[model samples]
Target: MDLRDRTHWIFDLDGTLTVAVHDFAAFKASQGLPADRDILRGLETVSAQRATEIRTALRQWEADLAHAAVPGPGVIDLLEHLRGRGRQLAVLTRNTRANALRTLRAAGLHAFFDARDVAGRDSAAPKPAPDGLFRQLALWGAHPDEAVMVGDYLFDVVAGRAAGTATVLLDTHGRHGHPDSADLVFSELSELTSRLATQPPGQSIGGPHASQKS
Candidate 1:
C-alpha cells in the first residue's frame, strides 16, 4: 500500500536526524552493563530502578557532549522540503525532552519544530508503545490514517504501526530493514525530499523493489 493521504510527519531524533559521538555501547559499559547499545534490552535485564539510573546517567553524558551532535545526511534539505510542502513536523524520540531540545538547538533544527511537537522521555511510554505518537496526533488534530512515522529504528516503526500511521524506515545502511513492521523504507532521507517534490502526500514514490538487503 502507498502512503496516500499522510500529512503529519513524526520523526525520530537520534540516528534519524543527528549523529551522536557518544557511543551507546560505551555508555552501557560505563554503567557496568554490557558493551552493547541495546539499551532497552539492557534495561529489561536490570531492575527498573537501576535501568532508570542508567538511562539518566547516559542522558547526562549525552548532554555533556551535546556539542558533538551533528546533523545527519540530508536532514536540513528534508526538513526544508517538508516545511515547503506545509507538512506538520514533530519529533518523537526516546531521549529526554531536555536532551532532545538541546540537540535540536545545537544542530540548528530547533526552529523546524515546535516545543509541543517534540516528545521526549517521560512524555509518553517511549517508542514501541505508540503513546508519544498518539499524543502528538491527538494534539495536532490529525488522525492515524493521515499521518506518517519517519524513523530509523524498529521501535519507531512499531510505534507508528501501533498508532495507525504509515511507517517509513530510514535505512541508512541500504539494508531492507523491517524491524518495526514498517510499510515502506528509504535508504536516504534525501530521496524522500526528491519524491515529495514530484509526488503529493500519500502517493508511493519509491518502487516496491529498491536495493535494500532485508
Candidate 2:
C-alpha cells in the first residue's frame, strides 16, 4: 500500500493523461453507431467487412486527434513525481498502440514509458475486461496488489477491480456515478500527486480497504 515503495502505476492514456478531446458521441455518429453504445462491443456484432471499415475509420480519427494531443493538468508533474519515486509506470489504453504512442509523444510523456509498457486494444481486450491490465502486470512482474489503475472513467474502475488492483478514479467533474469500485477518487491528478508527496507509505485514502479485491 506504500505507493512510493511498491506500487506500479497503470494508466489510461486518453482522458487520464491528456486533455479530454475524444468526443465519443461524434466517433459513434461517424460509424453510424448509436450515441450510447460501446464502440468495441458494438463492433463485435457487426459484419466482418463493416467492422473492418469502422475500425479503419476509427483509427484514422484517433490518429488525427493524436496530432492535437495536449497534456492534462498536472500530468507532467504527477508523472515526474512518480518516476522520481521509482514507481513502475505503464499505459493500458483502448486505443491502438500506434495512436497511443503518437499521443504520448505529442503530450511529451513518451519518455515515462517504454513501447512494451503501453498496451492498446491490439495488445489485449480493452477496458472493462481485465486482459490488458493483467498483461501489463505480467510484463512488470508485479502482482495486482502492488499496482494501481488510474483512469477517468467507470470502465477503468471496473477493469481495475476485475483485475484485483487498486482503483483511483480521476473524476474531475465531481460526478459520483461509479464510486463503488474506486478505492480513491480525486478531482485532479494534482490532488493525488500531492497526497503521494505528503502521505506516509501504506496510508489509506479513506477506502475501506487499502487494496481492492477482484
Candidate 3:
C-alpha cells in the first residue's frame, strides 16, 4: 500500500540502508560453525561462558564493519522526505545496538534517527520475529496499520507481516528478494522515493504482488 500514510517507519539496517557487504556464511565458517546455520541460534548450544565471549567478539566485529558503511543510492533523500513529513523512523537490525549506532554514524545517517529508536539483535528476538516492531509501535503509541517495515530480506517481510504492518522489500544487489510477501517492492531507494513523491493521499502503491523488478 501507499507508505505516505504510515507514521512509524521501521527499517532493517545493513543491506536495507547500506549496500550489502557482510559475509555471513564466511563469518560462520570462521567460527567453525555450519555455514548455513543461524549464528545466534547456533550460539545457544554452546557453553554460556563461551557464548558470551563469542557474542562479545561478534558485536565488536560488526562495529568494525560499521566504520566502512555506505548508504544506498537516494537513501538520504528518502530519509529527508520522511523526516520532513514528521515520520518516526526506527531501525530494527540483527546487529548489536552499538554496532547499529556505529553504522548510522559511519554512513552519515546518525542525524536521521534517535539513539533510543535503534533496535538491534539484542533489542528483541531478532526479526522473523515481531517483538522489535511491537516495541517500536508501543513507544510511538502507534498501531500496526500506521507503521511499515522496509528491508531487503525475508525476515523483514515475515516480521512485518507478523506485526500486522505493511512491508516494503528492497530487492537490490540481487539478494534476498521476495516480492510475493511484500506490500511493495522496488529495486532501489530512489524508486521508492519517486513513488512517495507521486503518491496521492489515501492511495497505496499496490497489493502484495505489486513490484518494480530491477
lDDT score of residue 140 within candidate 2 = 82
- Give the distance in Å from residue 49's predicted Cα in candidate 1 to where it truly belongs: 6.1
Candidate 2 lDDT score at position 210: 29
Write down the worst ten-residue block by lDDT for model 2.
205-214
For model 2, the stretches where C-alpha displacement exceeds 4 angstroms are: 201-203, 206-214
Note each model's CA RMSD in angstroms: 3.2, 2.9, 2.8
Residues 1-214, model 2: lDDT tens digits: 4455547999998989999998988788877876667898888778999999998999999999998999999999999999998889999999999999999999989999988899899999898999999999899889999999999999999999899988888988867655556877777888888778887655654432222223
What residue runs in model 3 are displaced by over 4 Å at the alpha carbon? 202-214
Determine the backbone clash count of candidate 3. Answer: 2
Compared with the true structure, all predictions reach lDDT values of: 0.80, 0.86, 0.85
Q: How far off is residue 101 in model 1, in Å? A: 0.3
Please provide, for model 1 over 80-179, each residue's C-alpha lDDT reduced to its tens digit, 9 standing for 90 to 100.
8878878899999888888888989998899999998998867998888999998999899999988999888788888988998888888888564453
TM-scores of the models, in the order given: 0.86, 0.91, 0.91
Q: Model 3 over residues 1-214: C-alpha lDDT tens digits?
A: 5677888899999988998889888777777666556888878777898788878878877877999999988899999999999999999999988889999999999999999999998888899899999988998899999999999889899999999999888887646545677888877888888788777787557524347322
Residue 106 of model 2, lDDT score: 96
Give the distance in Å from residue 148's predicted Cα in candidate 2 to where it truly belongs: 0.5
lDDT of 2 at 10: 96
Candidate 1: stretches off by over 4 Å:
1-4, 20-22, 34-37, 47-53, 200-203, 208-214
Write the number of the candidate with greater lDDT, choosing between 1 and 3: 3
